[model samples]
Target: MVKEIVLSPDEIIEYIRTEVKVNDVLEIAYNRVFAPGIVLGITPEDEETGEGLRVGLALTGEILSDYVEVDFHRLKDDILEIRHNPTGDKDDEEHLIIIEAEMFDNMDQK
Candidate 1:
């Protein structure tokens, strides 16, 4: 069995750093769809469990403001999907993810 240990946001950054270098290609998925992105940086965010991390990504070096703060608990199953950096016209694919405000209003129902 795989041992499960909860890690803080800072520790998560350290863990990812050891595995993936800056600018490494990665894909973020939600609700069964995937978006291509490149790693820019990682930062800590406050959470009840004290293990939230804000991940930064971009399509190119010119624009790097895309960010996502994911709770550590949500990562229990998978961390990421790593892929090779795209080349040629294939590199133009970009996806922007937006969370609807209603998602927060109904959290208690789940």
Candidate 2:
């Protein structure tokens, strides 16, 4: 289905720049050189479980995509349709992810 773009490029770039700068400064200030230095976001617990998840992932890994076509993105209102193709690597898991977003935040703004 056709979709509308909720976020403009300028907004995404600006937000990402601000985030990267803040994260960098904090990392340096605290002498934290670890991976996921600042792009780590904690996922809230499932409704059935009250505890948060322990998985850690970088912002890029979670948002950026090296593959396209097979993976399609369409933004409509507050919903984003993302169809990602499964690769031969990692057991090949095909999935269609529908995201509820205020804007198009799928592309890596880095």
Superpose all Cα atoms of candidate 2 onto the true structure and report the RMSD in Å to 1 decimal. Answer: 15.8
lDDT of 1 by residue, 19-100 (tens): 4435655554444535555666655546566555545566543345454443333552343333333322224344212211
What TM-score would each prediction reach against the true structure?
Answer: 0.38, 0.19
Query: What is the C-alpha local distance difference test score of each model?
Result: 0.43, 0.26
Clashing pairs in 2: none
Name the top lDDT candidate: 1
Candidate 2 lDDT over 1-110, as tens digits, reads 32223334333223233332221211111012222223233333356853332222333334452211110011122222221112212222333111223443469544
Please list the residue runs of candidate 1 whose C-alpha ends up more than 4 Å from where it truly belongs after superposition.
1-17, 44-48, 59-80, 84-110
